[model samples]
Each structure stands twice: as C-alpha cells, then as structure tokens.
Target: MSGTISRRSLSSPLSALALLALAAGAVTACTGPQAASEPEASRSASPETGQPVGATRHMIDNGGHDLAFYVTQGTGPTNVLDSGGGEDSSYWKDLVPELHEATGATVITYDRAGLGQSDAVPGPWQVESAVSDLESGLEQLGVTDDVTLVFHSQAGQIATCLAQENPALLSGAVLVDANLPPFFTDERIERLVAFSQPQLDAAKEDPDDPQNRQLLSTAESFVATSTAFHRATWPDTVPATVIVSEKTPFDGSPEDVQRWKGAAESFVQAGPHRTLIAADDSSHDVAKDRPDLVLEETENMVAAQR
Candidate 1:
C-alpha cells in the first residue's frame, strides 16, 4: 500500500482474481535490490530511511484546515511528490531524502488531508479538492522556482489534473506506476469494483480511517475526474515520463498483461514529451519494489525540465 504512493489501484484494469493474485505476489516477488538507490549511502541519506536527516515538517493552512508536509531543503529545483490513494507522505519515506541527495533539489512530501498527519476534510473525494490541498500547500511553501512532480498510483490523476489546471507551476513530471486514466474503461472498472466489494465493505464500516476515507473517496469520485481528464486533450508542452512495472502487480492472464502493456504504450503517446520505461521484474508497488528505478525516472524528469 505504498507508491512512495500507495499500491491502491484507482481502478484495476484487470480481473479481480488477477489483482488479488497480483497483491499477494507483490509482497514476495520483489526480493532483489529495491532498497533505495546506492546514492543513498551518502552521509546525508540518513540511516533511518524514512526520516531524512535535515528534513522538517510544516503545516499548511487550507482555510483553517491543515495539510501536513515535509521539506528536505536542497539547492536546485523543487521536487514535489504526491502519494497514491490511501497513502500519505510516509509512502515516500525511504525515497524522499535520497532523491534530494541524488539531485541536490528541494524535496517535498505531504499528507493529503485526512491521511498521515493531516486533518480530515469532507468529500465525495473530488479530485478538485485534492488538487486544491496541494496548491495551497505548495504556495504556502514558497515554491515559486522550478518544479518537478513525482506522482504515484492514484496521485497520477492529481498530477495530470494539476498540470491541466496549473501547468505553469510545473517543469517536468514522473508518473510512477500511475493510473493510466485514458485506459480505464467503465466495463472493466465496474467489474473490478464489484469484485472488490468485500474490501470496500470493510472500509465502509470504518470510513473515518485515513485509508478508508481515501478508498471511499476514490470509489466515489476519482474515476469520473480521471475519465474527464482523459477526454480532454493532453497537455503537450510539459515533458512527462511514465514508469511501469515489468511484471503486472495484479496478476492477469497473459492477454491481460499484453493489453496492459499496450495501454501503457498508448499512454506514452499522449504527448511528444512522454516516455514510458518498464522497471525490471517489479509489481504494482513498484516504488518499493524498485526504488532504484523510481530514483532514476525521477532524475530523468528533473533533467527533462525545459
């Protein structure tokens, strides 16, 4: 459940059985070297992993509501990260500071309202509300300089929507195992949701929990916004790179896997600036499974800023 963003599928494009298998396999399948990049061995990388050495926490007031965010100050561009559905800043625990160490850029991570250390907000879970929380947080943090966005899982919707609404604020983007909004069809999602009904019911019973709130919000509102986003013309001005898992996290049939890759390829064509890279032998929780690739793709985005 972490994308440096959560492992939550905004809507799985595959069958429920496959996704269940994918989740079960994701835990044990990635046994290799996903333990952050080697650059993290630097003195600045901090041994604690999640808590960076010099990072400090701050609260941004969104009309009396506070959004919790962290800052690891660096010298170059600002790298702002948005975690996937049901996750908060902690999702990026290991990668956040390591990223700053690698790039010498200001690295920021935040808990979307109702998750992590942030306060809760009422919601049908509208993407607009999530985007607003981020905007206020960034503005309050004085992010007026260059910016690169690293969005994971459900946060992909937020990143794309933000780019559409506030492209001027961004220089480049890295979509890590992000939601391919254009590829989700209603028939597929309806089936996936119906299959996930049991989990949804459990969360519905405890709706106040952060993950639950995020899950409910995603179920209620995220897809429509994502669909609408795909309907609009993609923003071609900003460069974006998509990092996908080499192995399907939600285990699908061979045909399912091929279709998923096909969709990823199509998504890469959204703009001339878009590129798609498949991480080696990873699952849906790709950031955790292959932190090295996440670091590399993010660095690629930072370099692509124009």
Candidate 2:
C-alpha cells in the first residue's frame, strides 16, 4: 500500500481547512471499500480492553522536527494518533494503550513540531510542512502501510490532506472534535488572521519567551492562512469517522456551532465511508473529557473495518 503525493496537489492552509470541514461531514454518503478479511474471533483482540500492556517510546527527527512518539504493536491495523493544538504526544497517554489493548493494532502517538519535546520550526507552522513531517516520520518508522490516522482538533486538516493525497498509506482515519470545512467563511478567515497578529508580533518581539513563542508557533502552524480550509475535501477513496463534541464551542456562539455542524455534515454527506458519533459530556478534548467514549467509538470503528 505505498502511496505518493505530488507537491503541486497540496492545498493551501485555508483551502485545506475548508475541504476538511466539508469532507469530515461527507462521510455519511460514502460507503466503506471492501477490506481484507480478518482472523476469527479467537484471534481478534477485544476492542473494549485493548492490547497487552507494554509501550516503547522514542524520539525521531522528521526533517528538522524532533517528533517524540510511542509505539504499541499489535496484530491488527497500525494506529497513528495526532494530537490537538498546543498539545503534545502525551495527550493520548491514557487512551492509546486502551485502544491498543482492545484492537490489537500497532498504535503510535507523536508530538507535532513546537509542541511537547519536539522543537518548533523557525516560522509560522505551515500545513505543508506538517504533512511533510508526518510523512517523513512514517517513512522513518517503517509503518508506512497498515496505518489508521486518528486526529483531534486542527490535526483533522493534516489527516485529511494525507488521506486525500496519499490514500494508499492509510487504512482509515478517526477525527475527534476536529475543525473542518465550511467552518471557514471570509469573515471567519479574517477573524482568524486578525486574531493571530498580536501573537505573531509578540513572538517577533521576544522569540525566546516560551508562552509567547508557543502562541506564535501554534497560530503560525495552522491559522496563518486559508490554505487549510480549501484542501478539506476528500478524494472518495479514504474511509473516515468523525466523533463530534457536544459540549465545546469553537467560537462560543450558537451561530458558530451551527457553522461547525454544517461543515461536519458536509463531510459526512460527501463520502460513504464515514460515521458520526456524538459525545455529549465532552468538549473539544474528547480524549480527556471522556476517554471511555473515545475508546468505545474507536473500538466500534476498528471492529467495523476488521
């Protein structure tokens, strides 16, 4: 399942984000492609409990990004968990092992550039750079195939781009309270751009300030432009599942929530190979607020694939 992507096909950050929001909801219209048959029940691991209990953690240099990752190998599909904004690889600490135990797959979790122990890049974080880093990391780890990408928040854009451009490298994708398409309007885009200037200026003033630097790094990483919004559409080949958050508000308004729902619904309607699950008690941090629900949905999705 080797996949290739042309540099020319990559979408701008705003475009990617828009397409992601659209693709994220379009899942309901898409059908799951026939996958290879799984082993008998006796051989399959329980999704509720996860895999045997050991994990190996390491740091790898993907280009210049110092990516810290943890691996738990299983007999099923490989799982790559992408952390949310300002979060590190440890974001999945409690949930990853549980997922591994239940599904019996090779599970991997990593810190994005500038977050956790990984060093941040010098400029604003560009979507292309993040994708490149992820691809490089996968190549370095040698788990290019048999991989299922689980993304949270803004990572949805990255995961969407990877699936669209390099579908062969992925088995499937799971999005947790992710930011998607249609969520970006001209006004929203302007707001995002406007919101980032202060942080950017702050970073410019004191590049060494950890808090200011982190703020600038995160803003630059995704919201610096509209490329992410435009590239959010799926290619109709990849399978996806979106776990929607019922409690958190991206913009803290009903109108904003409706926009988010519209974007999510767009993704579901665009593709047949998708599922939408709602988490009522949790906010954006689905993993932290309700690990049990996240684990359950993850199990269901994986089992369905198996």
Name the candidate that leads on lDDT: 1
lDDT of 1 by residue, 1-306 (tens): 111111253233221311210000001111121112123333242444355566677767776677677788888699998776666677788898679888989998888878776898876666666777777777767775478989876777677667777777888888887766555555445545655666678778988776766666666653465456445444787788888877554444444455556767888886688998988778777888999998998887887663
Worst 10 residues of 1 by lDDT: 21-30
Q: What clash count does candidate 1 reach?
A: 4
Predictions in order: lDDT: 0.66, 0.62
Candidate 2 Cα deviation (angstroms), residue 137: 1.6
Q: For candidate 1, report its TM-score.
A: 0.80
Off by over 4 Å in 1: 1-50, 253-256
Per-residue lDDT, model 1, residue 99, is 94
Best candidate (score: TM-score): 1
Q: Where does candidate 2 stray beyond 4 Å? A: 1-53, 195-211, 218-224
> Residues 1-306, candidate 2, lDDT per residue (tens digit)?
112222122121221222222222221111122112223342222443232235554556655446555566677678888866556666676787788888988887776777665677786555666776677666666665767778887787778767766788876778887866656666666545554454466457976754456555555434434444554676576778888877434424455556667777777887788877888877667788888887887777677767
Candidate 2 matches the true fold with a TM-score of 0.76
